[model samples]
Target: MLTSESRRRDFPTLDGRAYLNTAAEGVPPLAVGEALAQYFRDKQLGMDGRVPHAAQWEAARALTAEFLGLTAAEIGICSCSSEAYNLAALALQLQPGDEVICTDLDFPASSTPWLQPACPATLRLWKHRSGALHVEDLIPLLSPRTRLVNVSLVSFYNGFTVALPPIVEAVRKHSPALLGVDVTQAIGRIPLDLRGADLIVSSTHKWILASHGGGLVGVPKDRAKEWTAPAGGWFNLEDAFGPGSFEAVKSKPGAASFMVGMPNYPALYAVRAGLEYLRGVGVANIDAHARPLVLHCLTELRKLPVEVLTPDEPDHIAGILAFKHPKAAEINARLHAGNVHVMNPTGRLRVAVHGYNTHDDIERLLRELKAALAAV
Candidate 1:
């Protein structure tokens, strides 16, 4: 088991202020930063031309695959989750009048691609009453023409963790729809079994502790061949640099076909280091240590005048705790003024606790929050 003190050493930013905003962007560990800096220095020294770029990119892909419990061939390196969503939308073969079901609470990245006016697709929006979309509510929205059901594994604002297995089963049973997930919030903070999802998209910046501009897309093994590559670049070809390779050969199979261009190598190298760090700490153990801090925040916040929005059940919660006080903006301003940081999603305050956070940090946050409220 990794100790909190040792984990805290990994994040140098923890020395300055309380960082309770992993949901917005995680603090990359010193190792990842050093790896990225080394890559930058190597490039500056003109060693990038001598390095085996393909081998390094392939290794990065393999590391990401192992982290998500998928085959390397099933994972595609993307610039962001939004790009991954666009790839999934193009590959789904949606016909005219086909319906794409998504929730109102979904981040715009997951919904906007399907809403393109020229796409010849219909949008079915699921309503959220309490910042959550239950499976029962989704079932009523499903129709025979529904071709896809897209949702986030954990909501960005409220941190309501969806029960994905049952939702996948429900979608599969109700319609011949492809089930897609935006797992940006859930990837490193929670344990995910990717078998149930037909398509999964995530960014490495949050929770994974990677540099920005790196993302991942996971496609199911059985349905891999059904996806057609609409956006093609050199990296998507089997022999990208081979003689006459530009003659437009058949698209490579699986998630590799989704690759459009040369990936951000330095960002990927940093992501690889972050994945190695996550492996050393054990994602399950990280969740075990982090979840308690989230629960502690919830428990303590409930005692105050704040309205706790994140669910109390551990099974249905991620590392985020969201709440709203009557003077939420004022309280958040006060907290920030005191050198304590939290996320303000629109109006609600989101507190994301990660492995680097200690119980003392949570206590300090609670103290500051109470003081902020009193001042307000």
Candidate 2:
């Protein structure tokens, strides 16, 4: 039910500018601003407003659970994707001789926890061939000594959507390792069925159209019995304020254990509003709206001198696209000065198309890009 015209008003920052940088950080809609203001009004009440603020956190948790196709009990809240990864690594308790597999194309946060000096697990990299990861390449890396396999559903450098189900099956057939997936780039932009993985983490800032602070983590029902958070706090206790509040710490079971402190309630208010907006305009509808923009941009970029890094196949791509350019830094600055926004990270230009973008935005980008390439 979402159309480019209908959602354009939600983002007022697009006042005569092309925004192709959702992969880095999203522009929050007007509704998110109102939610933050409401949080401040509630904060004026001091101790009396605690119930309502806690309600906002619960609402965001339930909505996130629905978006990822999991139960409320399976979901937990964190500060960001890095905190979620660190919490998961602490819970894993990998010992010496155990190996953890990470892709060479993965973001550093995905593998850094396993590489800490105190971590007993050995870190291994599954190198990507031709800027893409294959299932067969990952199969050989799995063994009985493997404790975990970490990967992102979509690459941050280039929009190469990995086939996760095959990798899940391979892990089950090969070893007893737990499969952990970072869905920061995949959650709100694409249609996802994440129940197959053991651990899933995502941040709400990018495709979710919200501010940062609410990081989501999910664990399937089968693993809840065995999963327990290693750290505890007042938030993790059963009777946080009631009688026996400080007597003996009794940790809450399941995903709630990950909430070791007072959550970022202000940002969670924005997450609640953002998730509500996505529900109003279905995620599938957003995906359908973005494919044509990606196709249009890709078709025009092929005529340019840059080498396209995103796959052309329909199944392996989503809203993001990347291309290699020698003078990418200079070109990126030119585009920004011309009011055309994009990212040039590590010598690759990344173009991220979202629901609010229209054909006019693509045309502006192509026009500015053509001029920038010629001058550089």
- Top model number, lDDT: 2
Can you give the lDDT of residue 106 in candidate 1?
80
lDDT tens digits by residue: candidate 2, 1-376: 2555555678767868999999999887899999999999999999877888999988988998998888888888888888888878777877899999999868777889988999999998888777788889989888999988888898887888888889989989998888888888887788898757888888889988888887888877787644556676768557778777667666666577778799889988999998898888888988888888888898899899999887776677888899988899999999999999999898989999988888888999999999999999
**What is candidate 1's CA lDDT for residue 183?**
89
**Which stretches of candidate 2 lie above 4 Å from their native place?**
1-5, 239-250
Model 1 CA deviation exceeding 4 Å by range: 1-4, 44-52, 239-249
Q: Rate the local accuracy (lDDT) of all candidates.
A: 0.81, 0.85
C-alpha TM-score for every candidate: 0.93, 0.95
Clashes of 2: 0
Candidate 2: Cα lDDT at 20: 94
Q: Which residue pairs collide, candidate 1?
A: none
lDDT value for candidate 1? 0.81
Q: What tens digits encode model 1's per-residue C-alpha lDDT throughout 1-376? A: 2475775678766775888998998988888988787677667757563274455577778888887788888888878888888877778768897999998868889999888877788999977766677788888888789988988888887888888778888898888888888889887777788667888888889988998888788876786876656666777767777777667565666687778787788878878888888878888998988888888788898899888887666777888889987788888899888778898768899999888877877988999999988888
